[model samples]
Target: MLANGNVLHPRAGRAYVLRGGRIVVSADEIRNADILVGVDGRIARIGEGVSDPGADIVDISGRLVVSGLVDAHQHLDKTGVLRFTPNPSGTLQGAREAFAKYARNAPPDDITRRAERTMARCLSRGTTAIRSHVNVDKDAGFNGIEALSALRDSWADRLTLQLVAFMTPHPGQDLEWLEANIDAAVEKADVVGGTPAVAEDPFRYMDILFGAAARHGKPVDLHLDEHLNPQRPLFDAVFDRVRKFGLEGRTVLSHVSVLSAMPRDAFERVRNEILELDLGVVTLPAANLYLQGRDADMLPPRGLTRVAELVRAGVPIATASDNIQDPFVPTGAGDMLEIGRWTLLAGHLRGDELKTVYSMMTDIPARLMGLGADYGLREGAFADLLVTDCADVDTLVAGGADAMTVIAKGKPVFDTASRPVAGDEHRQPAGSG
Candidate 1:
């Protein structure tokens, strides 16, 4: 809880009227407008002459304001542990082995600290929403869930976090490990997920995941086909289970790198099914670029799935930063703009497709995370926004970490122009500002 004498000394009922800024309301709309934030922390009005007599009116001329970026896929616990765990082989299995060994003894506080550092980086760079996966098998157990769930409550005022209880089938990681821990994990998790593609019986693995999610009415986000094999039995299995379990519009498939290797006809057919099923697809460009295609003897291809084509097909797609400074990719700062820029360059999407790329960062993933009207810049919405010096969305993506201010729930919680790591504090209560 925040004391009356908390450092910022701002109350939750604090109201503000931002004036003269170029607000990017959505991918299709940009306008010079003023936004009035009410005492209840939602946008009261937005127009040319919006005003509140008692509200603090800040002049934001010459600034670009947009909704804070949303990261759909990430690993919070494994972030910032590269030095403690090294993957010399630089393959997915090597990264898994190195991290599993380190996690056998990973204390809860250490996990919280690593997650805190990475989240600070993300928030400072204007990513206010994230869906992070944590290991829930034998070696990792449930320590990560306990640690991050607390952070989820403490940080709710500024950032939205969705936890995925990720099941692993690494030998003994199965058997009694999931049976003992999965129920509790699902109750505490925002989504239930697992690496079904690697399981001995992929259908059985999905049965476990779907059953747990059904028990709690939670959503599903699974990792499958994390390779280049065009044969998509794993994806086919996922589509089948989603249909069988009535999980349509509530399932997300991450790291389906096999989609890139599918034949043109096959991709179109699968894309049509995805459209009908309303399943979400996530592409992790950075980690895939590092881990995929290592076995190729000649020039390596870009390790991402067919991003532009999938988006063109009207599938619900998101591009995200999967691993940050971990054994998975070994390099990242958790910047969504960096992720956006990399997606544009690596996916071979044309510059004219900038609006489509911007949607991945703000709209598509936010909807999947269940953050809808309250997330974006509109009347009656929660006033979480990113104000920067860039003139437009394209400029913001091209310029990595320029000085900016992050506003959460209508209050200026973090201003990079004046401070550092201010968003990391979880001590203050949300209502106390």
Candidate 2:
């Protein structure tokens, strides 16, 4: 044990055991087991009465342990700029205008500093992996990708950051210029991203993006049909391209909020098509809810994708914090739990539905990001887990559940219980104590 009351081995490749915690093995299963992480930073064993006398043991009896959270869709370049750039109209166009102006004036050093702070905040909240979309259009240039690539290497041990090159093109812009910028981004980014719904010609826009991705053999993640217009046919165009390029399971569509306004028959048809294509979907509840449905005169619709329905149809779907404190969404802490809460409320998840909602932030997104088979808390899985003071899912979902310990690759990186607080005794919650 160290001076902080947290037990962590000092030597390299040292073993440790987390004892007597309720481990969440899956969305529908929880077991009272002790986890033994081996010297290789993988789970050596997980079961009742599991023990390794040579390993250091941390007694976490009566605690709840779950896998680390995965945020599949996020905008790291625009994080923490809401105060400086406010969107009074709170519409998608308003956000675009505000951010475009800010990007022109913001320096690379300033962007890096803000992104680093956001990453630290995400780490403290038990997010072990993230897929962040960086701006790659002509206005922002390659500055966002360059900064994020450096940060990804610098913070490799604490967090896994996958950078996606996001191409945001304005109407009537020269396609040749946009294609050249995208080519530069693909040379440096892990994935290629585009917003087909905002393009002047959705088909040509998708053709350019898909052509670039195919030529480079990179995966595609597009922001499709983000508006409230139900008559827009951009989503069909995307499905056609995915089929034509045979990019099934390698493509992801984020923020299909327009589906919420579709008629029942049309919605089912599109949902089935998505399942057939084996494409993944990411819902941005915070940004969509704030930016969409603002023009409705009465009984405004909730700007969200069909989460429950898609999950029921065996479609791969996940939820994420799209914009953190930016012009699109002026409030967020980069917390998956908070995002889960919003999903629960907006998606109408309750009772056993809560389990699927929780998985949206953990297992579902991890699978979408193609995290390897050894991602969860199995025998051969990586030792990335979060131990909270809540003993059950309900308590954790009810809010105020403190993350007691966070382990990244078998190392105790965050210990909330050991942190010194400056406050009265009563102010601290029982779980943190």
Candidate 3:
């Protein structure tokens, strides 16, 4: 029995104690013990027979406790608007056109409503941290930034939301207007971002983004090389800019889908450079799979980065649900486990490979977002955790188990004993989910 006089169960209590669970300290380490969360919302201790008479104990003897999930890339402002704006062609350009049309007429409150719903869904599914890229172009204005900034503060107690000002300039658009708007966005956002591949002058695009980021002392997260054209490669130039600005670990490139189309020798050379530069890569499998490889007539290529090779080469790789039910992805629940499942199948991850796949959602992205030493499930770390029904990673991935309790900073922000059916479990065809 707990100090609060409540029965020991999944929804027992968040009163400073969690006991009798299989705690996953890392991908390779799992221990049966108790976790004591201190008053400062951090893990005070983890061991056997830890007793605290004054604390509320939530017995999870058969449950699996792991770190709270992290989303390295997301689009908060554009979430859950798929029904209003449909992309008939199912291509990148189609998505762009549809979103542009919608954003042109959307008011700030509408954006806030949709974003709030999306974040609520994310919290319900055990996501504790997310890095969202909000549109900063003329159509979106500063509506997204203002709405998401308020949401970030309001949800600060329950979730860590980091905003990146995503500058998406179309062709023939005035560069001066784009740069000025980006400057404004930098003042409001935590990270500076742009789609370099979409810029008419890719180098100049990198210059504007990096210059503003350096001036503002913000990190860079760019959408780079999302196309499958082997002739056009923007990674080298992006790497050169990072080196030139001495922003090695401070830069992240999302959706380098062309890397999967590279030849073996070229891929190896590029992989080595990426490692040397110490850059982070975020593979948005959901959006890439839906948007890319549309023009191929025979045997369309899988639109994904070389995740297996990058993991093998010791490069930092994180996977995310980029767009949720928007014109780009058309379907997503903002669940990292679903993203992990997709990554596993799309990347051909099996056997021992599950460890890396699991890390892509938890530790790896946490590090990339600069969450520091307080992120994981170790003693003396912040008590942000997720307790599920499965005992191991293999079953968690195979079964897509629901997180019974999602704790952030020693507090259970979301918990439910009712196990919802895993939406990724054979609900649709292979690639559709």
Candidate 4:
């Protein structure tokens, strides 16, 4: 404890010792120990009975310690749209129109305020970093772009913000215009995002976009098919181009739910292609689930990408809360734990599969964000961590990381105090007898 209530301070590597918790150093290492987070917000020392007199300490004896979560794919501008109940007949068209209107009418300040609030909520829930796709289509007129850019700047200390400049290659704008604008946008952003669904000739469009990305030395993010019609071959074309350019490990495919509906044989071929290309997959559960099943019958495919298969085949797979109350997804409460729960349940993860589910939100995403070296709980890693209301990974998802504590750069960003209920305090009712 500090002499004052304030958590901010200056010291020569004063140790922060979290005593006696089940420390999840990584996905596999879960051990009971005193983990010391040193000054400058990195793990300095970790072991049993590690003590320091000048150190600040917290007793997390009954909880679990985990690395800060990361959402590898998200949409900052689309996060404030209210959740709409789906209309069986008007699902796709209605949702699209609603979002388009939201994008047009939403003021820049409103977008920035909502995105900042969403980022705070995500941080409170232990998501410390996110790569958000801000729609940069022709109609947005710098409002969305400026808003998202400002959001990234304002929260730079707490979050790792990667912008995907999503382009609109409408007929009037044409192929050449799209290429020129995309090249310029990369200099202004971290990645180049496009929608193959919006283009009449998606193959040719992807070629242009990917080529531009290679030329600009930026990554490629695609809002692939999230529809009931499963015949879109954009993923195939993506794999081919990435392979041809040898841009392995630099491309990301988002919302590829249509791939789930493909036959096993066809999926095998495409999956193999994706693996050979070594491209990354960002599964956005919130948006895809809301957008997909528009024309479904008895069996609605899980709108998630083939995460388990991809991970088993050594392909990098990550998760994101694409929208939080935005037009496309409607409502995403900005909680990654919620996304993890949906992933485990909807993706049929059980037993040991829980570890894989957990990785999607943690180290795996850190790798995607290029922070692998300093992402986790090991010594010399950043002191960004979460104290969860769980004994292990399985229980954490079930309990929703409740009563959690979030630490960023070795300082408490959020802390929840729990009080026992009156007359039901830690015992059975007396009237039961």
Best by lDDT: 3
lDDT of model 3, residue 52: 66
Report how far residue 360 has shifted in candidate 4, in Å. 1.5
Q: What clash count does candidate 4 reach?
A: 5
RMSD of each: 6.4, 3.7, 4.9, 5.0
Q: Give the TM-score of candidate 2.
A: 0.92
Residue 104 miss distance in model 2 (angstroms):
1.5
Model 4 lDDT tens row, 219-300: 8888877664566656667777887766788787877776777777877887777777767777877766776675667676
Q: Give me the overall lDDT of model 2.
A: 0.82
Against the correct fold, how does model 3 do in TM-score?
0.92
| TM-score to true structure, per model | 0.91, 0.92, 0.92, 0.87
- Answer with 1 or 4, whichever has the higher TM-score: 1
Off by over 4 Å in 2: 2-13, 418-433
How do the candidates rank by lDDT, highest first?
3, 2, 1, 4
Cα displacement (angstroms), candidate 3, residue 371, comes to 0.7
- The number of clashing residue pairs in each candidate reads 0, 0, 0, 5
Q: What is the C-alpha lDDT of each candidate?
A: 0.82, 0.82, 0.83, 0.72
